[model samples]
Target: MRTADFHIEDARGDATVLKLTGDWTTMGLNQAAIRLGESLRGYSIEQVDLSELGRFDTAGALALVQASNFAMPANAFDTRPEAGRIYAMVETLERQSAEPPKRQAPLVRIFSKIGHGVHDAAAEILLSMAFLGRLMGATGFAFRHPGAIRWPAWVSQAERSGLDALPIIAVTNFFIGAVIAFLGADLLTQFGAGVFTVQLVAVAVLRELGVLITAILLAGRSSSSFAAEIGSMRMSQEVDAMQVMGVNPFQALVIPRLAAMVVMVPLLTFVGMVSGFLGGMLVVWSQLDYGPAFFIQRVSEDPDMGTHLMVGLVKAPVFAVVIAAIGCRQGMAVAGDVESLGRRVTAAVVQAIFAIIALDAVFALIFLELNL
Candidate 1:
């Protein structure tokens, strides 16, 4: 046949010829694909012929095969002798385009992950130790450079984190003491030991309730606030900007808050303890006909002031570190944007609270063992 234009006509019935002309390259193939797709949309395009195709290339061949694949029933065009080569090429393309099956990690790769886990654990431990060391170094530096202790910032944190939280601590501790007394009186009344309810309430409040309740309250109040404040500053790019301006984020942002909490939580705990004892005394006097003397005598007799003070005071420093660590970590980790900052702040608060509780348990176990 002479090299000329190609035409597709129906194989059966009154055939209408559709012309395919010009050099068949990528654009020609695209045009052919578009025309075939458009014609097939509204009409029942059952069959097409490319026998007159001239100057056809692989692109044109592929385009014809794609059109045939979509317009015809499966395996109907595959059986044609002229389409056998095109079908084979399409099969190879389909196979090559398919995603390869995934393989599970082998024993070696699994062991390698395990090894990395160990290294990560060790690195975390070292990081924690380094953090503590840095705190100690900062404390020492503050002692040496007393002027560097930003009094205004420290006072601001103390008033906000500790002084402002005072009313809440007092109120909660008072209710807790009242609840303890009421519960103890009811339980001891069966044995005609209602008078000794003061002793029980006093002992529990002084030894455990004071520190525990104060810590829980601070966890909810101060720690969360710290995290949110730090996260906000971080998200606002203030902390990074400080670093750019040659400011140590730790000293400028974190150390003052830590120092304030360390000094103030102990004071706050003492306030809570006093309020709790008074609340118990109130219940005892009203319900059990006992006096304030009874509560004072009972609590003071067994638990030394030094012991109570030492227990709460020691926890203050630890709680301070926990709050600062969580806040600073969350702040430094803040990605840009308000949503990420909010998430980090919430996570920091939750994690810090859980950590404080765990630390409190460990402290309780150790102190009980030490007879403190």
Candidate 2:
């Protein structure tokens, strides 16, 4: 059969008529609709003669209805029952599209956003405190029953979070130390006290940068890994299985990680300190032509070495607790989806880093007050 087509009868006046002929099927309806719409655009369509249309499907009906701008009256077209029903459906859809959407006031929207953020922050803080409490309880229980401690898991985590991370940590601290030495030497040279560069590197690396860099690296490495691993377990229902089998997820999953961080972070901090010192030594020897023996002599003579080293190491355990807790807490918060796992892992790393920096600032204030 011939494809459906339409032609304008008289489109110049206020009342226009469209005469459709042949088979009005899907094959030709789209083009037919375009042509019909163009012809009817200049005038108000008053009549549609579909009596000559041989056969039409729902597709054709929709095309004609849309081309008429959903304003075609019921009596305007002599359409088959199927086409009439299709026309009615399109009309309903058009009415829905034309509806004006409801909008909120700008102030209301701003306040709603602020309220949601505050609520989310409060909820996150509460959840973190609850997780911290659980971890402390687990640690106490392990201490009471030494046999319950997962030594193998703890050892394994230590290797991953400590030994394996040494290279990058060393490289990072080394470069930072070198940069500090260079800056210090350049500034102090003007005052003819270039030797004080050793003092600057020693104080900064031993007291702050070493431990801070180590914690930040671990926050990125171990925290993200912990979140992803635990989230995967949750996704696979392994955590649920552990619960069903009477295994405490906290003891099995969280405790070993917490213990590993507590023990290894201090060791990593020490490594960072040594690496940074070596870096400073290299910079001093190469750039300032200072001897290693002289640099060591100056560093050892500094009264703040003992105090700064002690203060820096002291922060390691606390930083470890925050990093591990944030990681595992975010992991436990994961929902049952890959997207949720990814989001939780990202949030875990970000939160861990922020917490470490904030806690470091707090520690700095405490030490300053203590005059250490």
Candidate 3:
């Protein structure tokens, strides 16, 4: 086959005419393409002549179109209708693809960004509410048909999220109690009321720190775990397969996690409370000369112990619900990618922790208003 070739003819008006020749097919086009660039450098072609062109194909059409900068007029290919059609198609596609998108004005861009943010936020809030409703509906289904409950999964999650978390929870609360005791003692001693440090530690841990710390710990550990587990199922499309099989993903995946958190959080909080008490009691007995007997006597005589402990325990179930809701909601939001899963998992932990703190503040306000 003849090799593809090109030569610049005399100038036409302000631009030159690039005449192509030879078998302008794929087999002969590679060298012609490179040479076409060098030969046409610093010369703008306003037209192309394909009359002598032989065996032209898409590759050759592309080379001619590029060498002429896609500016060839239709009449330039008077003797080669097929090559002209190919060149026209390539010219249209290349010119369209090579054009850049228009840039928006700065003010328009700012408003566009804000609008996108608001839209995304609204969509997210709606999705969260829809998932919450699904969870509640699943819960009602379980209540109406107890057999729908996944007892094995619930037990497994409880053991994992609860029993496995005990050591860290106990240790964290213990140090917290010890630090509170030290602060209370140091501050109270300045006012000649050092002995009351035991009461300070007792009330703080029992009323707030114990349950609060447990909730925060579970938010970090259990919330992320729940999101990751369900998000993986989502990524693998196991959740979709369950749906195809007429299985409720909410009851199967979400409820077990919610049940696990609901059942285990209170037990964990109770353990945390006891650990805190022990820590503070020991610190006071050793440093402030307050014996175990004196610590117990003060804690028992304070009528607020029962009320405060009840208040603290009451927050456990609500906090558990928040953690489970945030975790399960984020999990269900996973978009079938590693990046999506990671983002949802991180959002689960962050939103759970923030909700817990905000809810704790609300609880504190309600209790204060009620004089409890």
Candidate 4:
């Protein structure tokens, strides 16, 4: 077949003519279009002559149409019906491309995005609240009919979220307490009150650090576990199956996990407190040359032990509920995809930790007001 070729014929007025020749086919059409396009740049083409064209294909037709800027007048290709039809089609596309895109002001776009985010956040909060209400109602129902409670599931979750987690909690809190004691001893030594490190460690670990550490750890570990477990169940449609079988998913799936957290967090907190205290005692003994017996005596003599311990333990149940609720809520929100499952699981941990810290702050304010 003949190779495609085109040339701009010199014109006298504002209108120019592109004269195409040879076979207008895919082979060598792109190069022809490029050369023609560059040569025609300084001229405005209002017409095209395809009478010299021997043959034509879609690609070459499109290339010629593009090179002409789709401005070929209606009568320009009337002598060649094929060229006219192809030019008409490409002209429609060119007209469509000429339309401007609708755009919003930058400030308006920013506000629109902010409004969408706020709306989504509010919807999430309302959904979480609804989940919490459902869980609470299910819990009350279980309480009223103790036989309906899933004791086996609750025990298994306790083992997973509590007993199995003890070593990490204990080890973590121990080092934390030791660090605090070391710092307190160094600071207090400046005032010749290094002996008071015992009281400081005791009060800090028992009243705040111990429970907070346990709660944070559980938020990362157990909360994520809960989300993943329930999320998998959701993905596999097991939760829906439970509902179809007349089982209340909240009671069957969530209440047991919630009960596990409620029962175990305080216990873990107590263990963490003792572990941290022991760690502090070890640090005091080694760094300050203080005996364990003397340290124990100092801690026991602290009159605020009862109030501090009570204050710490009182927050455990609330923290447990919040963690469980966040975990289960995110699990229920999981869509039918692995990415969604992973995202919800991460959100569960983060939201639980945030809620724990915020609630702790509120509790602190309330206790401060009450002078507790």
Highest TM-score against the true fold, candidate: 2
Off by over 4 Å in 1: 1-133, 301-306
How well is each residue in 283-311 modelled by candidate 3, as lDDT tens digits? 89888998989999999998889998999
Q: Candidate 3 at 117: error in angstroms? A: 2.6
Query: Over the stretch 280-306, how does candidate 2's per-residue lDDT look in tens digits?
Result: 999999989999999999989888899
Could you tell me the lDDT of residue 56 within candidate 3? 82
Please list the C-alpha lDDT of all candidates, in the order they appear: 0.72, 0.89, 0.89, 0.89
Task: Give the distance in Å from residue 336's predicted Cα in candidate 3 to where it truly belongs.
Answer: 1.7
After TM-score superposition, what is the CA distance of residue 359 in candidate 2 from its true location, in Å? 0.9
- The per-residue C-alpha lDDT of model 1 at residue 98 equals 62
- TM-score-wise, the better of 1 and 4 is 4
TM-score rank order:
2, 4, 3, 1
lDDT digits (tens) for residues 13-105 of candidate 4: 666887888887777464787887778776777777777887777777677667667655668778888766876776677667756767999
Measured against the true structure, the TM-scores of the candidates, in listed sequence, are 0.67, 0.88, 0.75, 0.83
Clashing pairs in 2: none
Model 1 scores a TM of 0.67
